[model samples]
Target chain A: MLFVENRELVVPGRLLAEGDYFAGEGTFLEGGKIFSAVIGLAEIREKSISVISLQGRYIPRRGDRVIGIVTDTHPFGWILDLNSPYTGNLMVSELVGRKVDVFREDIGKFLRIGDAVLAEVREVDERWRVQLTASERGMGRIRGGRLVEISPAKVPRVIGRKGSMLKVLEETSGCRLEVGLNGRILIRGRDLKKVNAVVEAILLIEREAHLSGLTDRIKAKLEREG
Target chain B: MAEAKPEKLLVDGRRLDGRRPDELRPLRIKAGILKRADGSAYIELGKNKILAAVYGPKEMHPRHLQQADVAVLRCRYNMAPFSVEERKRPGPDRRSMEISKVIREALEPVLFLHLYPRAVIDVFIEILQADAGTRTAGITAASVALADAGVPMRDLVAGISVGKVDGTVVLDLMKEEDQWGEADMPVAVMPRRKCITLLQMDGNFTPQEFRQALDLAFKGVEQIYEAQKEALKEKYLPSLEEGR
Candidate 1:
């Protein structure tokens, strides 16, 4: 039985369910009861109950796309700051997709220390050592784009239903948005006004993601502002 | 406390502040108010105004201080020079340093520190206005800030002070009561488990009176806990209900 209503904001230690439900992320099972482990909105599915936390530091997970800045370099790879508690290691092989002799070749020719890289988490161990790969299409170094950071939890809302909101944003504002799961969004457009409009729209989504009918409101806002 | 007692602290059944002995002063709490901090809260109780900011579960600095198994909880409790009636000196005094230590311990139990090993969680409390129960108020605000920052915890901590004044156990003592009452005790409790994370007493209390004061403090903390929950809901959940 559900003790708290679905989509209701629940604080930590709140009893979310009591019987015959599996606990998911942001929830813990004690004896026969499930309790929320963060301040977030609760969700109860067919057999699982979980909470969607509204605020938190991002934890790196495998297969997650991330945008990171190179902070330090090791003999094997460059450490990328994932805007999370843990950093990601982007090896020269992963970035270039080829093996190189460290002594014979300078890896700096491919990526600089301060360059931004669009990458994906290849692996993460129990100790939070993150391995990043940027050999995929449209990955690797980011050249020039306005970068905006939002709450990581709100990234899904910014993308919206099957990329519907993203499509609308691209079409109306005439801009392409490369959103990272780590909460960094890169915007590229010829028109400065349209790019700024997309930034505003992203901020609005972050603030009002909990509300409904946000897509239409955003469309209206873009039309009015554009 | 003042050396001399007032002729009457309770008129009929109400205390000097026009409240029952068990009533708490008005509280205003808001979470996630800061832009830079990971989590932050602003609280106003009676005439006391406080701000709390939480940072981390991030990497521990000083390389050597990182605990291999758990995150370290560090807290700082500071009062502005102009916070009280008299202008106080700035920086960490011995009293502020002691309060900072106890506040850290008060919040450590609820946090799931082991989840983020080799990290540190910093809780900073700044008192903008002084009241009688600043330490309790600081703890109350810091816990909310921690939750706002998305730190996982067993439960939120709620705090209050109960004191004996005019032979009566009054809840949430006022500044005047804190100074003039016969005894003042501040208590912080983890509301879910009903465990005392912080307990400090001064002045005097008989065995029976101490138990009664604890009961009143528990009652006061219950109310504070409710407010803390509502404060968080009001920030994120109210919009969803409003859409309907």
Candidate 2:
């Protein structure tokens, strides 16, 4: 039996379900009952139950696309803060797709501190050491896009199902948005007003992440403001 | 040297504020009030106003403090200069320092700290008004802020003070009762599990009185736990109700 309806608001430790249900992310089971582990909207799919959290710091996972800020430099790579507990290491070789001699080559020419980067997580060790790669097309040091960060937990909502919300955001506002799993979003648009409107809509999704029918509301908002 | 005791703490079964013994002061709690902090809460308990904020589970600066197996939980309990009749000096006082340590320990038991090793979680509790039981109120508010931040925990910790005034046990002591009470004990408990995470005592209590005081504290904490859960839910549910 599910104690809460689908999309119902749930707080940490609120009983979610019982019996054969499998607990998923943001939920835990104990003593034959599944309970939420964060304040969010309860999501139920068949026998699996999870809660979509509204607020949380980003935790990096392997293969996640992230936008990061270069914060420091070491011998082989530049350390990037992924807006998360763990920082990602972007080796110069990985960024340029070539091997370079440390003594002969200057990595500073590749990436400097305060540079914003779009990279993919290559690997994560048990110690949470993350390695990043930017050699892929359209990945590397980002330039000339207004950056906006919402709560990382709300990133999926901004993307919507199958990129539906994102398509609507870009099409209505005439902006191209590059969203990072770590919550950093970059917007490029010819119209400044439209860019700011996209930022407003993203923040609205964060504030109302627990509510249902958000995609329609967002589309309505974008059209009304545009 | 001895201070004079008040003439009557309980008159016709009512305390000075017209609340019965074993009764808690009025409480109002709001979650996620601040914009910058990862999580924040504001609480008013019998005029003892407190605000709590949680940050991080991010990097722990000064590197040497990083724990290999668990995240470090840091708590700071500070009373504002204008909180009381007499101005409190700025900075961490001895009482505040001790309260900070115990509060950290109180919250550590429930957190899934191992999930974020090498990171640090900071809980800041600021007392804007002082009417006794500030530490307990701070703990209650801090736990709410932690939950608002989405920190996974076994359960929420609820806290209250129990004391003996006029040789009778009471729950949630006001400043006046604290000043004249025979004993003052602040306690924090994981209400669902009924496990004590914090217990500090001053003055006197016999074994029997201590047991009774714990009973009262547990009951008070249970009520506080409900309110804490409600505070988090209230932030999202009502707006959702209207949307539907």
Q: What is the DockQ of each candidate?
A: 0.63, 0.66
Over the stretch B1-92, how does candidate 1's per-residue lDDT look in tens digits? 23466678888988878999999999999988998999999999999999999998776778699887788899999999999878889999
lDDT of 2 by residue, A1-226 (tens): 9899998888877889999899999887779899888888899999999988878889988899999999999999899999998899999888999898989988889888999999999998888789999999999999897999888998998899899989999998999999999999999998898888999999898777656788888889989999
Q: How well does chain B match by TM-score in each candidate?
A: 0.95, 0.96
Question: What residue pairs are clashing in model 2?
Answer: none
lDDT digits (tens) for residues B1-244 of candidate 2: 1556769999988999999998999999999899999999999999899999999889888789998878899999999999988888989988899999999999988788998988999999999999999999999999999989988877788999999999999999998899998999999998767899999999899999999999999989988998998899788678678667
Docking class of 1: medium
lDDT for model 2, on a 0 to 1 scale? 0.90
Error at A222, model 1, angstroms: 4.1
Give the runs in model 2 whose Cα sits over 4 Å from its true position. Answer: B1-4
Provide the TM-score, chain A, model 1: 0.96
Candidate 1 lDDT, tens digit per residue, A128-193? 678999988799999998999998888988898899888888888888889889999999999899
